[model samples]
Structures are given as structure tokens and as C-alpha cells.
Target: MGVIEDLADALARDVLEAQAELGDDRFYEKMSKVLGELSPTTQEAFMTSVRVRLAEKRGRDFLARMLAAKRSGGAAPQAPRGPDSGH
Candidate 1:
């Protein structure tokens, strides 16, 4: 991966770890507050980057699970990494 891809992967991994630690409710709460404070364009860009990074690192299935967990306010399952945390 290029430097930007590597950075995006790192960011996705961090977000996954953090969401697991915080559980869905708190994670969504924090994200909603932060996103609400951002401008619409910034929010769109941020969410797009986040989704792309997550989909790249963990696959569409994982991204779906993450979104489902967030919507349901439940804990997210651990990332399905094979080795090196799939980074």
C-alpha cells in the first residue's frame, strides 16, 4: 500500500479498536456529537473516508456489521483479521 493507504488502514484499525472498547452506544454518541459539530461538507468527506478505509481493511461484510451494530446500539464484534491485525 502507498503511504496514504497505509495511513487510512491505520486509522481504520484504530477506529475499530476504539469502537469495540466503547461499545456501540457510546461510540455512536460521540461520533454523532462530533459529526454534528462539523460542517456538512466536512462530515460528508469524513464519513466517506471512514467508510472507504473500513471497507478496504475489513471488507464490505465487516463494514456492514459495524454499521448494523452502530444502528442497533450494540457492541461490535472483533475485527476478522487473519494476521498482523489485517493491516
Candidate 2:
């Protein structure tokens, strides 16, 4: 990855860790604001990294749930629905 991507990825990891500890779901937004003060390019990269990491985490969680359900001979778990999902 390029310098911007590398920096953004590292910052995204830190933000995730902080959010986990503080239980503040809006931490990413706050970080975005701070990055915006630095530069629009940096802020955009950070936001993209943050979003990708978040989506990955959600997929991991869903996979774990599905695995657990399968082990217990239960029904397969449903994928999480986003606001854009009509279901």
C-alpha cells in the first residue's frame, strides 16, 4: 500500500481499539473530524480504511455466529441487515 493507505490503516486500527475500550460508537466520526483538520486526502483515506475494517469485523462476527450455530445443529444465522437493506 502507499504511504497514505498505510498511515490510514494504522490510524484505523488505533481508532477501533479505542472504540472497543471506550464503547463509543461515534469514535470514528470524531477521528474523521481530526483527520479533516490535517488534510482532505488524509481524511478520505482514513475514512475508507475505517469503513473497510468495520465491514471486515462484521463479516468475521457473522461467520463466527454461523459456525457456532452449525456446531450446535441449529439453523444457520442470518446476515445482518443494513439500513439500505429493505428486509
Top-scoring candidate (TM-score) = 2
- The candidate scoring highest on lDDT is 2
C-alpha lDDT of all candidate models, in order? 0.60, 0.91
TM-scores of all candidate predictions against the true structure:
0.39, 0.86
lDDT of 2 by residue, 1-87 (tens): 999989998999899889978989879999999989979899999999999998898899999999999999999988768799899
lDDT of 1 by residue, 1-87 (tens): 655555444644466568877766236335535755855444444455567755675677788898999999999978756676655
Clashing pairs in 1: none
What are the candidates' C-alpha RMSDs? 13.3, 2.0
User: In angstroms, what RMSD does candidate 1 have relative to the true structure?
Assistant: 13.3
What local lDDT score does residue 51 receive in model 1, on the 0 to 100 scale?
A: 70
lDDT of 2: 0.91
Deviation of model 2 at 27, angstroms = 0.3
Output the worst ten-in-a-row residue range by lDDT, candidate 1.
24-33
In candidate 2, position 63 carries an lDDT of 93
